[model samples]
Target: MDHEKVNILLVDDQPAKLLAYEVILKDLGENLVIASSGREALEVLLKTEIAVILVDVCMPELDGFELAAMIREHPRFQKTAMIFISAIQVSDIDRLRGYEMGAVDYVPVPVVPEVLRAKIKVFSELYRKTRELERLNQELEDRVRARTAELENSTAKLRESEQRRSMAIAAGKMGSWDWDWITGDWMWDEGQYRIFGVSPESFEVNPANVQALLHPDDVDQLRKAIAEFNSGTRAYETEFRIVRPDGEVRWCVGTAAATIDANGRVVRVSGVTVDITERKRAEERQNLLAREVDHRAKNALALAQSIVRLTRADEVKAYVNAVEGRINALARVHTILSLSSWQGAELSKLIDEELAPYSLGGQIRLAGPEVQLLPATAQTLALALHELFTNSAKYGALSTRSGRLMIAWQAENDRLTLTWEESGGPLVRTPKSRGFGTRSLLASVESQLGGQAQFDWRAEGLLCRLEVPLTRKTAASPAPGKFDAAAAAELQRASG
Candidate 1:
């Protein structure tokens, strides 16, 4: 629990200033790093766990502002606090820019040693408090885990005790009978007569009587299970159908254990039998329900696949190759959804996989932050990328060997911006008419992703931009429909 060894980073172009600050804060008991240049400061920050950075604004080759910007851009260094020290007077705009670049405070130079030391102490105390809180939280978690383990152990013991009590009560209420092979005799308990629905005085203990009471189909299995138990090869647990003298059939569960004489010869086999007709019926019902559920799920998936296949069928032979290809795309989306437990898809990876074929040969470039997409967003984006790839392959950048395309996206403050740029295709001119592919992309982006789509047909190439809000992504999604005929016509007319 040593709180005195907190790490601090000091960046200044002047050696004298560095030494002066270090001397003033010597009593604070911190490990202070002094760098004479911004580059040197960055090197120090990279190698160490820096609690705070005190930087000089004016320096050669990456000044404080530039260095701060670099730090903010890096995900690992995003949370590091920066304090700027400058001798020159800074305007309101300059101060605002510093704050925008993630500077937490500004210290004027020709510095006061006492005031600087006190500021350093305040930051050091805050860092210590954060570390202390983290330690306490970890301790609390460990205690909770121990308590949970004890509760689980107690619950297991209680379940085991309950099971033993249930088994004893079941044995007492039911009945048991035994057969002595060596003595060639049979015996039955009082409860056994009750189970068979017979009076003890009317029944005689004999093999013939027992055989007559058992259902014919279960006689062989019942004998086999008993024989296996006597040979010490298996525990005796068997289910069979039994018939009463009055001709009523009932399901029964029988369990037996073997008794061996002194010579290691089987003396007798004894066990309990219980009526299990209700239990058997319940099991059958459960099995039927399970099969029905499995069948329905398969049919639903097949129906969805059929809908996708039919909708894309018209464009298959003329624009693409076959209906199977479109179906496969839909299947791939389904696979992604399944792998994520139907949660959604990762937007960047989805785009990369869908565009990989055309992206080869430097025809396309992709860049984006990692963001998860809802099911609707995933399907819409997949279809849009498909149309873009198809159009490019037929007449745009992907048609020529020398063409290039850049597909990039960025997420900023909960908004996502995606851009598609093309180059080195046929001489750029306005399209004569809007096509099905163009219309699909626009409608899908707007309605499915809750986004805006803009098309720019510049002389250099065709550029498409989309902007979307990230909040619309959800776990459960509604079905996405196809683009209307009017939108398709509009795209065709604009292009023509």
Candidate 2:
């Protein structure tokens, strides 16, 4: 018999991409449908059956994630495979969200022909298998109904119907069981044997055999549920863990109903058992993510509070500007962190952003290896850089057209040393007294970051050197946020 082709849907605002996808998948011998927008995609999906969907992540009106979520809500499309393609970097959180929204896979913008074709082929085959299984189940139900109505069927026909029923049930991870309490008799189907990791030819239908495969910790819960059912509970549902013969533990849930005799005594019980190991694992991961979000929120609030509390200004305008600048710096760093799923950010990118206004022309020079700063370290550095940038614009190298600033850094032996050298500006001189700016700068480096900062006053300009302790692993763990007044005062006094 000639096989019917499964339809593959391609969605993107760009026609070029849709055309490319069509060419790549045309050889698979599947029917391809192209849609330029999400609304159009939905219309096509409603009209025709789709085995797989390839959608662009960044689109007008509806993005790939929103499209996937909507499609998943439709019962007919819940099992359809969806692949998300994006040009932007996918963070850990974004990848997790994609999976949660029913995305089967993710592909980068520059599509690999071989990889894309292989993934689509696999899902398409799976779709065909699922359709076949559904057809088999429908046939089995039909045969059973026919046998029930016409009880005069031949023995061979009856045997074929029984085989169909068993095959249909064996294809799924669920099974039915029956227990006769009155006669100490039990019965299980082929599906039940597969669920318990055993074969019908080697398995026995008895309480001892069933209990032996149950996890030790969950045995009591199961027995308690049985006791409750015995004590007049008509129906009850409970969960337990099954320890398979291969030493793998899997979670299972069952709903059973008691069959009462004429005198109100239990005679038999029947129910369906389902494997739910993946669901349990998803729940655990969600709990962990919740805790991590809470931790990050607290860290951000602490950093913001410190910035607002320690900032000082002589006038209302100055105070507002100072507070705003510091918070804006924090916000910039937060954006970079979000792109990396709150991981560390590169040192060069952070400096370029903080000094964007003064970065016009060749005034700002930077020399450093690619260094990823811990998220906390980046926050601390952002606020401190804001102070330095502000000072430079008002009184340092950036204030003059002919002036220049050179920023350099070196990382060696698990430490990062940086310098800010300003030249060709007004002559520099040592101040007679320590001001709020000096104290604030010292505290940012010495207290929150646990780093060292040294100032040099020259006739031409000023140069500052910083030594920070950093490593890759330190990104997740942060230093204390509280500012130390005594330490800041001592550093300021010594510097003066």
Candidate 3:
């Protein structure tokens, strides 16, 4: 196969040897540069990109080793291979030093011209293959980049077409608006003006005028949505309140997509708006009904848990019967809150009922911030606390007349921490084997509450600590009114 041209630098002090090498390698089809001295060779190398160098070891000013060292020092010629030629018999150490100076081979002079030519041919072929491979790799990379850019453009166009279809569908049912960010112009479908209860001719649909129609409380949220889309941080899907021309406040869902220029500047946002006043009212009613059902289900589950706890108490009849009785008392408190719709249960009421069964004239002490527990969390927590109370009443603090139980809870930064400490009870130590109640407590705290639970069976008494995320409890609370459907679809298409 044909090979790319290789530039060879042949350095020698003797003119006869240089001419002999040139004549021998003339058939190799490579470009050869001849230098009579080490200084002349260095000058030739500075001007030409030579792939290999053949240098005479015995030179007057700079020897082959010294010239090789200089070539290796220059980063541009660092990888260029050097071969040392010498008339003197090369020593093992001297040959080692020449190789260390980056000589690939050594040729004894009074040279074999054919052997020298063959070595040059091998190196030239290798260099040609390397260059061809690099060229192919660069071409492959260019093609891959071009293909990737084409795919991205096609994907963007598909998404834009899908968004336009969605806007058309939404427009058939409700109102729609398309904003041209480049020109600061807004196009509104007829339904949009009708939904806003405004004459299409009266309004010049633009972001500034749209802001004027938004409820004061929702303006900030709408602005934040637009800002997120424009910054490419997120697509816009915001619900905000818009006041109609008739002076009535209505909820509107806004959806929008940002179009970017080649330089990635936001050029436009296109989307649709929808009216969802009736849907919002229906959702509110459904939420109320769901909360009621959840409360009742929690109460029923609590009762069932109490029954199971009491039945298991007989299986270990050798232990005290007070464990089962205390569990029943906890269930009764859960039932009372369930009857009231589980908005929340008072902390004091929960404690009072759970301890009523183990009362030696109200010896248990409860203190800390008075907070209500959400229905689901309160039910599981009550059961876990009931188990702890039962264990204390039988084997630890609440078992004796001098024993006392302290229950406390606090909320901070969306986390609720509850601690149970007992004093003046029987000496406590870690159990040899964990019981069902112990496993239940760990599971309830870790799985349901999404928090950590610590149980320390210290010599003083049994201490239990629990931490739970508070967001699960307060999600039912209503927030300020915002947009509904039409604005949401509009924002979605604009963002898409």
Candidate 4:
């Protein structure tokens, strides 16, 4: 767009009319280009960017209509304003034709300079504003192009940074999450889905589904942590256990912070989680071993005290032998328990250890279904068997070659029933008082095991019947015992 004074083209075949137009429009402060014919006007149009054109209606080869039509045909001059001036009156059709050729107005004979100047002024101003608007639009487009290039460069750098961060997260096997504070909706990354043992596509990400992965024991603690975070009392950092879909319980450590708005209200919470199952299991094993050491120490002390308090001997030598023998019986049970990590001892093994000396002798007979007893029960039962074995060897059944002993046991619900029957020995009668051996046997079964012990002296033999509970809850007072599923399975196998 040119900022110079707008060019106004005046075309007339007669030089007089051309001079008249020039003089009239001269004060309008515009450049007037004169052409003697329609052809001359087109030549002037090519040289200058014209604002308006006033031409005579009658001409030799190219009239005003033809010149206007020719100007309008050019793309550059399509908006150039046109006005027709003629000495002869124009018909309505001719006026309309001039208008159709894009003429702005038609004046006959002498022209009014004021009206012509006013019309030219109006068109010139309109062209100036249109050019100014085009200039502004081009400037805006240039700025947009420059800004778009800068934005493209920034976007490329951002994508590279995100890729590097994603690789780092994957290599670490760490999970990340965002939780909407108000909606309870969850957004989890691929690593988070992996940690929870779920497929990203298959599961809906939500707080309720995440809670489903939490171990029942850890749910309350998780809630408390969330409450503390909500109250701004703590940044969320806690350890918890999650039960995977496959029933594996895994430990996890999570750390998070709440995003707050300007009003100090929570906007969202975001965090990282890591699976620490292996570390947690190692710690649990260490604790378990510690507990086992403590339990074994207490048990050893209790057994030693019981032995010293209960033993009744005539001499120091006899007392030492008695204590040693009881201790040896306990040690044998310990050996059996060691094979099973001290979970329990087998009843059959306990019996066999007490009767080892008499095992080869035809006088001893053992018959019983397989039964498993708690370590405490096995220990006491072993001592009682030892006392019985000693008695039978001295006066009951095993003292004679023809004498025989029969031991059998059965288990039902929580109780175990064992019978010791002796026969073919010297005639036995009911004793008036109990001996140290008898008293020890009674105390072991009745006091220590919290069971019933009975003795029957018949003419041919001595019979003993012991009823005890198979679990450790029978000791002291009744309580829930740690039931060994493995032991139960062994019993089932034996029965089968």
Overall lDDT per candidate, in order of appearance: 0.74, 0.83, 0.75, 0.81
Q: Which stretches of candidate 1 lie over 4 Å from their true place?
A: 1-316, 319-325, 473-476, 479-496
User: Residue by residue across 81-139, what tens digits does model 3's lDDT show?
Assistant: 78889999989999999989999999896789888987887777777777788789999
What lDDT score goes with residue 260 in model 4?
85
TM-score of each: 0.36, 0.55, 0.37, 0.50
lDDT of 4 by residue, 106-171 (tens): 877767888878887888888777888888999999889889988998898899888877787777
lDDT of model 1 at residue 165? Answer: 58
The clash tally of candidate 1 reads: 10
Off by over 4 Å in 3: 1-330, 472-496
Best by TM-score: 2
**Regions of candidate 4 where Cα sits further than 4 Å from its true position:** 1-189, 202-237, 241-250, 255-272, 277-289, 476-496
Candidate maximizing lDDT: 2
lDDT of 3: 0.75
Ranking by lDDT: 2, 4, 3, 1
Which candidate would rank higher by TM-score, 1 or 3?
A: 3
Alpha carbon lDDT at 435, candidate 1 = 69
Point out the worst 10-residue segment of candidate 2 by lDDT: 479-488
Off by over 4 Å in 2: 1-215, 241-252, 260-268, 274-295, 472-496
Q: Candidate 1, which ten residues in sequence have the lowest lDDT sum?
A: 475-484
